[model samples]
Target: MELKKRIEKFKTREFETNKEFYLGIEKGQNPHTLFIGCSDSRVNAEILFQARAGELFQIRNVANIVPRDDDPDNNLSVVSALEYAVKVLKVKNIIVCGHSNCGGCAAIRKLNDYKDDLPNTAEWISQSSRISDYIDGKYPDMNEDNKLVLLEKLNAVRQLDNLLTYDFIRQAFDSRKLNLQAYYYDIGTGDISIYDYENEFSDLIKEIALS
Candidate 1:
């Protein structure tokens, strides 16, 4: 069967299983968390968190990156979403989540020749250029596995910094109205490591959980 026909069949049957939950959500959505995840199909926030629809306001992008706004116009979508989530939606926390074995991370290192065909996607993900600089001479001879780990961790920190650049986000954080977090999901190990900005990407998941 065609993909659209398969999708239509699922849409027809989905209502019976999920309509009640979705109906109540239409009344209003008051999600407490804004989950920033990757565009990777493998990373499903709902399933990973065991959350229902409307429980998370999700923003997805290449390498799960959120751009810093030297000018908000430079990143209108990222800035606008942060404005709504922090000022209007009042989400308590924002999560910048990255995962292992990410194609976006790999694509950054190998500036493949798809530039002719997929020029826009190539340019869009170039926001991740920092990853290349960070891993430059440091991993010149490192294996692919090690390179990906470095990419995953660096991307998370880069995005965390980007998340902080917005005034609304900074104000919310300073006023204690919001919290930000970064995590790397390891596909091979099914383990998640939280990156600490303070101790230089130190693991503080345990200490933070105490709060």
Candidate 2:
């Protein structure tokens, strides 16, 4: 009922007010950025970006994962959007945004617990298992809460490396035709920390890539 009312209000109020803007974009879309974010309900891309309609193309998925080119189980849904965003839309920026208290990232930490009941989720998030293992091995003394936070941030940045595995993405990045960034949004604090492709996690991501 609440959602239906909101939709009705959007049609009667918001749409009427911005009728021209909406109709102008109806013919075609020219979004400037490709925002790849988590499927977390709390992380609303438009609200966070303060963007209007037709401004951003988006891909939302568990843990905000982008499969590497070499990944045998690469999910076509995500890769297809990415390819279209870059090749067809010619989006100048690609932002992979992960957020705090992410259930998906939390699941990756205890993936074995879900392997039986949530097999598909377990397999999907298993892509970032190496990142979790690295944190455990390197920060053995870090508390659970802090470890999760670190994992969330690193996992966001790691997707940038995964994005580079695509030849077209790498070419665009190398030629400065495309910009890739990772963002860690703290839902509670209303803060977002942005990371460039070559950030603190670059070395770690390189090691993981080599492995």
Candidate 3:
């Protein structure tokens, strides 16, 4: 009932008031950025960036994972969108955003436990299992809670490296035609930390990529 009312309100109020703006974009969308964000309800890209319709293209998935170009089990859905965003839409920026307390990241931590139940999810997030392993191996003394937080942040940043594996993306980035960034959104604190493609994890991500 509440959901229906909200839809009704949009039709009667917000939509009607923004009819011109909406109709102007009906012909086509020219988004400036491709926002790859986690499928977390709290991490609303539009709300966070204060962007309106037709301004941002989005690809939301568990843990905001971006499969490497040469990944054996390539995720067609994500890669297709990425290709379209860059080649077709010509988006200038791509932001991969991950959030705190992500269920996907948490699942990656306990992936074996879900292998019998959520097999697909387990496999999907397994791409970032290397990040978890790195965290554990490097910070063996860190508590689980802190480890989870670090994992979430690092996982977000790692996707930037994955994005660069594509030749087209790399060409655009090197030519300064496209900008790549990773964002860690803390829902509780309403804070967002932005990371560049070449970050503190550059060396580590390079080692992992090569390995």
Stretches of candidate 1 exceeding 4 Å from the true structure: 1-14, 17-20, 71-73, 139-141, 199-211
What CA root-mean-square deviation does each model show from the true structure? 5.3, 1.0, 1.1
**Model 1: per-residue Cα lDDT at residue 207:** 25
Candidates 1 and 3, the one with greater lDDT: 3
How do these models rank on lDDT, best leading?
2, 3, 1
TM, every model: 0.82, 0.97, 0.96
Return the number of clashes found in candidate 1.
Answer: 0
**Please, what are the lDDT tens digits per residue for candidate 2 over residues 1-211?**
6999999999999999999989999999999999999999999989999999898999999999999999998889999999999999999999999999999999999999999999999999999999999899888999999999989998999999999999999999999999999999999999999988786678877876666
Clash count for candidate 3 is 0
lDDT tens digits, residue span 16-101, model 1: 67888778888888998999988999888888788887779988887888876773437677667778887889999888889988
Using alpha carbons, what is the TM-score of model 1? 0.82
1 or 2: which has the higher TM-score? 2
For this target, which candidate reaches the highest TM-score against the unseen true structure? 2
lDDT of 1 at 171: 84
Q: Please give the clash total of every predicted structure, in order.
A: 0, 0, 0
Candidate 2: regions farther than 4 A off:
none
